[model samples]
Target: MKARVTVMLKNGVLDPQGEAVRHALGALGFDGVEGVRQGKVIELDLVQGTSQATVKEMCDKLLANAVIESYTIEMA
Candidate 1:
């Protein structure tokens, strides 16, 4: 099985890197770009029958920083 994890900043969080990207894009004439919030997508290969609870544990333990970010895991 494979688990895909997406980690992102929560709403109302400040993202200076994202702001930089947005500003650069606008300078490049990509004016339609409004906002950009940087995030990460991670894929993990796991043994079959890996539980959602276990995945969440992994996120809590290592994959995500709960103080600044949130994560969602999808299994395939």
Candidate 2:
């Protein structure tokens, strides 16, 4: 089995890295680039019987910062 986690910053939090990318895009002649937000994807190889509950617990403990970020999980 495999799993994926997508983690992103919550709205209203400043994303300096994303902002920098946006600025660079404009400087490189990419016009009308209004905004940019950055996020991460984590791919996991798991045992066949690993439960969604366990995955959620993993996110709560380590994968995401609950105070400022959110995460979604997909299993395959």
Candidate 3:
């Protein structure tokens, strides 16, 4: 089984890295972008029976910071 986790800053959190990227894009001539939010993707390869709930536990315990970030899990 494969599990993919996406971690992103919650709304109202400051995202300096994302802001930097947005500014860089405009400086590079790619205008019209008003905002940018940065996030991470983590792919895990597990045993055949690994469940989504198990993955969510991993996210809750280690992969994401519950105070400032949120995560979503996809299984395949």
Q: Largest TM-score belongs to which candidate?
A: 3
Winning candidate number (lDDT): 3
Ten consecutive residues with minimal summed lDDT in candidate 2?
Answer: 47-56
Q: Order of all candidates by TM-score, from best down to worst?
A: 3, 2, 1
Q: Estimate each model's TM-score.
A: 0.94, 0.95, 0.97
Question: Which of candidates 1 and 3 reaches a greater lDDT?
Answer: 3
The candidate 1 region of ten consecutive residues with least summed lDDT is 25-34
Candidate 3 runs further than 4 Å off: none
Write the residue-wise lDDT of candidate 1 on 1-76 in tens digits.
9999999998899999899999999999998997999999999999999998999999999999999999999988
Worst 10 residues of 3 by lDDT: 47-56
TM-score of 3: 0.97
Q: State model 2's lDDT.
A: 0.95
Please give the lDDT score at residue 55 for candidate 3: 97
Q: Tens digits of per-residue lDDT for model 2 on 1-76? A: 9989999999999999999999999999999999999999999999999988899999999999999999999988
